[model samples]
Target: MDCRVVVEAAVPVYDVSTADEAVRIAISKTGEMLNPDLNYVEISMGSRDCPHCDDELEPAFIAADEGLVALELEMTVFNVERDEHAARIARKEIGKRLKNIPLEVLEIEVLEEEDEEEAEAADEPTETEPDGGSGDEDDVLPEFEELIDE
Candidate 1:
């Protein structure tokens, strides 16, 4: 499948060397007002209720620029498996965590799967198969991934 998950959300960032520092600064910025502790975010894609294994579709792989001290003014998660329900939950949780920061969301675009094998599978359609027998449903590296990794 040729699917990708795209997310965009504004965040307040500060100059920090690592993700740890970035997290601290980000949290603090959002906490400058009332109920600050309520808006502490660890990662844009992570779940507020559960930190571990609770991200918006786990990243199969990742490589940051890691060039210098910096905090994220905005964060995005992309090229993940598309699920409307999950996306909704993830975004809502994130919004709550970043409530103090006041984010300006631009867009969340997803490149859903295109059944490459459809052209072939049609010739062998099942009598009553679920989702066309998952033909061409396997995840593949998104095209943009190559550009970023390069």
Candidate 2:
């Protein structure tokens, strides 16, 4: 089974003046840490809301030239036996990259059969002609043959 895991990370950024700047710097730092190996992971700002009024809240908090930004890192874990297993794998993989950063498993969604099929179909290459002609090798233009002959 495949599971889509969303992990919340509290990333620390320094020398930031605004919440937006903190968030941006945090994201860039996180990306730099997880590149080349886990490049498929999607990183985005974490969602926060006021408990009483349910109003949207800023994902970053700044204090004295230091900031802690809330960010969500999502990745799909494939061929797992259970949801818990997938979550553990995701946490371990992400934790190794973002050392010392606090992480919490926010959500784990099991990929449906239809979703898997759709993903597979999208990955499969489609055969098509670039010039809107029939995809047949015998249909090559004679001008192209002249170039090859030369």
Candidate 3:
């Protein structure tokens, strides 16, 4: 059972513009150089995206001209755990490695949209449900066995 990690991070910045600059800073000396595996940075006038990460943390980094700019970055690592618990453990360890980030400087949000997506997809009607049948069990759902017998 292979597991994957999705990391989203954004930091308030100033005097920065363009994705290339952000990328340079991200992979540069003191900024995000620690996370060598860092995959991307998104730019929105001042923000950026890796174009390589999983969820496309376009929302991660942001920026401004004068007041304060923000930079967003996203990344994904594969085959790190054996299951959900192991994944969580790996995440905790990774979180510690990222503790140097200042909350006031950067904001990181790692949402579990995969589960949400799965729930949304599961809500869609399956083939067993007739086109117009209600959700009730007694609502005359189609049965493969009945069709075969017929």
Candidate 4:
């Protein structure tokens, strides 16, 4: 099963005023920190979905908050278990690459192709009932009344 993960991170910049500047600095730092051997992983600020049409849109940086820039990283792993681990590895590498800048991982969302059952489950609302047994009956609770007293 193939799994995909989208990691959203907020990196703080002290003197950056514009989103473009912040993105430029982030990309540069990422490039410096990336290992040549792990070039198979794809990292970008943009997504594969098209904004205007059904085509791919150009990558651009967006400011999440004042003095902070948001980054979106898309990566593929072999299994669902490896999604979070891969994101952590990428975060660690980026942090090591930038010593002065402080990077904070905001969220890691795992995206996998879901089957019909999974989709239906996700769409449906589940009703949970509270425990039916009242606490008044102590004898039928499985433990001895004296043991519970102790």
Best candidate (score: TM-score): 2
- What is candidate 3's lDDT per residue for 58-111, written digit by digit as tens? 322434731222333333334443445434544454445456543121332344
Model 2, 1-150: lDDT tens digits are: 999999999999999999999999999999999997899999999988899999998999899989999999999999999999999999999999999999999999998879779978766656664554455656566768988999
User: What's model 3's lDDT at 87?
Assistant: 41
> Among these predicted structures, which one has the highest lDDT?
2
Candidate 4: the clashing residue pairs are none
Give the worst 10-residue stretch by lDDT in candidate 1.
Answer: 65-74
Q: For residues 1-150, could you state the per-residue lDDT of candidate 1 as single tens digits?
A: 122233343344544455555455544554443144434333333212236855543211122522111222232344445455445544565566556443433344444434545766675658665556545444344665666998
Error of 2 at 33 (Å): 0.7
Per-residue error for 98 in candidate 4, Å, reads: 7.6
Model 3 error, position 121 (Å): 36
Candidate 4: misplaced stretches above 4 Å? Answer: 46-66, 79-150
C-alpha RMSD by candidate, in order: 18.0, 5.0, 13.2, 17.1
Estimated TM-score per prediction?
Answer: 0.26, 0.77, 0.33, 0.40
Candidate 3, superposed: residue stretches over 4 Å from native: 12-14, 29-62, 65-82, 100-150
Q: 1-150, model 4: which lDDT tens digit per residue?
A: 445545554555555667677677666555555557445545566333466788864344344543454556554555545656756665565556555554444455555557756977655644541343344455566576667899
Give candidate 2's TM-score.
Answer: 0.77
lDDT of 4 at 46: 38
